[model samples]
Every structure is written in C-alpha cells, then in structure tokens.
Target: MIRSERNPAGDPSGPTHERVFRALRTRIMHGEIIPGQAMTIRGIALEFNVSMTPAREAVRRLTAEGALSMSKTGR
Candidate 1:
C-alpha cells in the first residue's frame, strides 16, 4: 500500500493521503495490504506527506472497521 507511485488515473499529482487511504482501504478490504504488511502510522504519514496525528487517526479508524490490525505498540 505504498503511495510512491502515480494514482490509478495515471496522473502524477500532489499529496494524496485521502486518496491513498481510500485506495489502500479498498485493497485492504480485498486483502492486498494484508496482515503481514502491517501498516504503520509514521510510514503512512511519510508516504502521504501528512502529519502523524492525521495518519494515526486514519489508521485508528481503519482498525475500528477491522481493516487493519490494532497494535498495542500503536506505532
């Protein structure tokens, strides 16, 4: 679920955290990011050019929806 590449529309553009998160959620719901990949707050924040708090919030929501795993470490 890396966002270093262009979007599905094939357009190179600006920050896409919401877009990235949406895409990842779709893949994750479809089991693409997977349990093994283990998404992290900092990593996603870095990937999407956002702050950790926002990334944390997004991941927290996903965990709540059972999309991603909740780590006690909460990294």
Candidate 2:
C-alpha cells in the first residue's frame, strides 16, 4: 500500500530505499532516535516492511551524513 504522490519538483515517493532513508533521516534529525542506540538492518527492514538492501542503504547514507554513528562492528 505504497503511495505514488509526487512533489512539485516531480520527485515521488516511489523508491523503497529513498523512503526508508527519508524516514530514518527524519527521525534522527528530529531527535527521535536516542544517541548511541543500536540499530540493525534486519530490525529496520522489519519495522519498515522493506528488504535489508534498502535498510542497509539508508543506514550507510545516514552514517555518511553524520546522523548515525557506527560502532567498531558496524552495527
């Protein structure tokens, strides 16, 4: 039950990766996610009803953006 709504700039919420990234990024930016919290790919995938690929991508992007910190084991 994904929506196909597009923005004025023609950007649509059509990609699961982007959608997951946006959702996680938003939560991090809004301080919804506690600091030093551990997050797993499988957990995120299950929470968003998406695959591990998208969740992994979102996590990597967030880590790159400094929104999330990775541990030594890359959790």
* TM-score winner: 2
Q: Give TM per candidate.
A: 0.62, 0.78
Q: Which residue runs does candidate 2 get wrong by more than 4 Å? A: 1-12
What tens-digit string does per-residue lDDT give for candidate 1 at 3-61?
34334244364334455567668888787676767667888878766667657766766
- On a 0 to 100 scale, what is the lDDT of residue 22 in model 1? 73
> Number of clashing pairs, model 1?
0
- The Cα error of candidate 2 at residue 71, in Å, is 1.4
- Segments of candidate 1 deviating more than 4 angstroms: 1-20
Q: Give the per-residue lDDT of model 2 (tens digit) for 1-75.
A: 443312212446656778888999899788898898888889998998777887888898888888988888777
Task: Report the CA-based lDDT of candidate 2 relative to the real structure.
Answer: 0.78
